[model samples]
Target: MPRLSTRTRLLLITTFPLLVLFVTLTWYSHQSRQEEVRAELAERGQLLAAALASSGEASLMGGQFDELKASIYGMMQGDSAIKRVTLLDASRKPLVDVEARTSGQPEARYFEAPIHKRLLYVTGGGDRNVGTMGYVQVRMSATALLAKQRRRFYIELGVASLGLLLCLSLAYRMTDGFAASLKSSMQALRAADEEKRRLLQRVNTAVEDERKSIALEIHDELNATLIAVRLEAQQITALAAQAQPAPLAGQIGDKARAITRLALGLYNSGRSLVRRLRPEVLDMLGLQGALEEMVNQYERNHPDCHFALQAQGDFAGLDGNVAISAYRIVQEALSNIVKHARARNATVALLRRDGRLEIAVADDGVGFDPAHTAEGIGIAGMKERVQALGGRFAIATANGTRIAISLPLES
Candidate 1:
């Protein structure tokens, strides 16, 4: 599964708590509104009852019960909400039922109205006699008040929902903005990594080019001069053998031959140094040609040992880095063979197969334990050169020393 971006994760973490709070607040507000509505209805009912009771009490005390009954009847007619008003004796017997048509009607007759569902307040008042003066009861319909409260509750719910939606939208936008920023930063880091790899490759190429230049100078200039000096010394030795006193001639010949030997040694050392610095044939004759030249040189120097070169496929237009690394690895392997392998025969092979270039240098030599021997600078340098070209290096000595290098066909 793909991963969630950091901003999205953070937003979820932030929004979850907010959502919980919103739900909690909404629940609390809804409950409060319900209680307030109920309390408001009860208060309004109490006020109506109190006013009716006061009017009835004053009327009864003033000995004007009939007038009071008429006034309540008139009041009921003016306000439909006042379903009924009544005066009852202390024994709970009706003295007057204003909603009834007859003045002498019992209070139980007023209970016929559906307003009795509200259970409006009832108060008792009467004289201390065989029959009490009366009590008063008043009721008003609660439907309209209940409807208003319900409507308010619905409105509050809608507002809360809208507010929640807005909050979520804002959170989503912020999360998206943060995610975009993070993506851009990641892209920049990837680009930087690619550029760094390219720079390292260019540096390796420049260093290899300089090595080739120095090798050419040594082989073409220094080695040529040494060869000339050796030829002149040989001529001097031949001329001295032709004309000189007996003992003096012998001494002159020995000195001239010694000079020639020294000059030849210098020339060989210079040639070896040039090849070690960089093989000129790698650039002039290509990878295969370079391998062959190295094998021939090694064979000439170690006449007792056998050397061979083989090629399996065309290597034209191979990447320069691949060619250079392959050549250097083979060269180093052969040098090791001559200096330490004590080999009687060595084979160098170059092949292209399955979109890969493979180079192998093997020798039938007294191979040393690879684990016991320290990785000298030569092997490390060869490995680094191969890695710079994106290649792999391996060494095996089960039967004899064998070094193999492989590089991708494309750089």
Candidate 2:
């Protein structure tokens, strides 16, 4: 099953139980209403039976059939709900039966009561009950009663249904509002992230450009001056060699040689600085050639540590930004391995597959815990550079340190 969003989950969680409760309450209400109607009908029927029995007492005892019939008819006319009236003698035999026939069986309520007569003395002081005269049976139609109950039930059900809908709608609206707010927050975060990436990209580009400019200035001005100074020192040393005073010539020649050595050291240091700022080979030979040269230099500098480079693909088509980022990533990785990774050999692989360039640098080194160690400027710069070009940077230190990057060729 597909996962549900917060809104959907909230809707189901809130509404399902309410739906079950609504159904249960409705059923319960219907049952209670039915029972109430039945009870009311039964009570009404009993009261009607009692009233008829009281009114028809004298007629029943006197055997006045016409009078009893008149009384029953009058009562029936007064209330249309009285469906049938049956008067019976002491033995349960019908004396006078008057029925208002209805269409259905067990469709109306029925009630019966006994009729009794009391004896009076000649002195006008009334006495007690003497005999049982007869009984009265009344059948009451419940159609009107049932109709009213149904209307009431319908009204209650409608109100309940409306309430349920209102509650559910409110819940839905609340969840939807929450979800909208959450979505807005997420969009804002993404926008901020995009802006941060753009800013970092611009910074990296400016810094690289400055480094290149400074390298060119140093190479053109400072290195040229040092070369000129070195040539003059050598020419002075050659001229001083033919001087007549042996000690003076030896001292001057030694001084000139010393000056030339100092100038030579300064020139070499300047050149090394230029290379550190920006390697010209990167521009001349492309990313692959630059990486090979860098690896050779690293091996030379760290004689104990072995370095190897393997390259495959048309790196010529790679974008400049992507190439630089890849180069820098590899450069930083190797530097870290040399500084921290206490191991012998490192491997650098550059491959292009499916329109993207992949670079992996791994070393058989004592890997350090990434969580415990903070990344220095070099590692951080490499990460920022890769992200600036819309690429991925991943590093793992378990087993051995590995840094992997993938960049789109077009980008």
Candidate 3:
């Protein structure tokens, strides 16, 4: 069976008890109605038997059996509920038997009464004694009354069923409406997430463009000015060698050497800034070479730590977004490993699997709980880059902190 939604399941859970109570109450009411009908039938049977017994006693004592028979037949003719009537002598021997010849099968209820007359005591003490004359037994038919009750019960059951169905329909409608509302809300949230990803991707693109522009400006303007200063200082050193006074010439040569040193140092610093702003190596070497170069630089910087790179599959002609996001994720992971992990060994792996790029960075060092780890380690930025490209990002810290990411390639 298909699984029920939360709303539907809750409705069923809440309704079950009420459903059971309704069934139990319906059955109890039906049984109570049946008992009442039977009791009334029995009461009428008793009253009828007693009345006939009292009236027929005089005729029975006089041996007028014909009148008693006529009286019983007439009573049965008027009342269809009466099934049979029988008169018996004091010895329990039946005298007159009268029955209603009903067409259909009829059920019966029986009642009996003793026929008696008041007689004076033999001692004439003024108190009367009772003498048994005969007995009368009456059986009343309960088929019609019971049938009416059954019909009423059937009607009640049908009404109850209709009400139950109506309630269920209403509940189903409510659940359906709730499910629909929930679905729409979820869809809206998904749409909002997509919009956010698009916006982030645009912002990343703009920022990268600005960085490239700044890098070009520094390479063209600042590097040229520093080179001119270095060239002028070298020319001064050459002129100092041709001066007449040896002491002055030596001192001027020393000052020119120091100025050249400062100019060269500033020039080198400017070149390094250009490289950081936008690494030209990425454009020249592709993702694999760029990553290998990065790992080498980190290893050179921190000789105490050994960094390894394992690259598989072709990285040529990859999408810029895929390459950059992967690069940034590995960059951040390595930075975190060096700064926080206090690791002696770190590994970076890149794979092209099933038209997607998979990147993993791990360090065999101290690990920290992700929940407690500060976002200053650039973990949040890496996750956003992956999410903006609609990829999966995961982190594990079993042995040490490991960041894994997968981004789709534009086919």
Residue range 314-375, candidate 2, lDDT tens digits: 88867776777787788889988988898798999999989889999999999879799887
Backbone N/Cα/C clashes per model? 0, 0, 0
Residue 205, candidate 1: C-alpha displacement in angstroms? 3.6
Model 1, range 263-293, lDDT digits (tens) per residue?
8898888887877777667778988787778
**Cα deviation in Å at residue 116, candidate 3?**
40
Q: At residue 266, what lDDT does model 3 achieve?
A: 89
Please list the residue runs of candidate 1 whose C-alpha ends up more than 4 Å from where it truly belongs after superposition.
1-203, 238-246, 283-285, 295-310, 336-349, 360-376, 392-404
What lDDT score is found at residue 355 in candidate 1?
A: 90
Q: Sort all candidates by lDDT, best to worst.
A: 3, 2, 1
lDDT of each: 0.73, 0.85, 0.85
Could you give candidate 3's per-residue lDDT for residues 1-411 as a string of tens digits?
Answer: 999877777578667876998889898988898898779878888999999988987888788888878888888778777888889999989888888897534454479999887675678566453788889998877777777888999998999988988887888788777878877887899999999999889987887789889999889998899899889999999999999798899899899999999989988998888877777888899999989999999999999899999999999999887777677678778888888898999999999979899998989898877588666638888888988899998889878878888898888
Choose 1 or 2, whichever is better by lDDT. Answer: 2
lDDT score for candidate 1 against the true structure: 0.73
- TM-score of every candidate: 0.44, 0.61, 0.62
Candidate 3 ranges with C-alpha deviation above 4 Å: 1-167
lDDT head-to-head 2 vs 3, winner: 3
Per-residue lDDT value at 216 in model 2 = 91
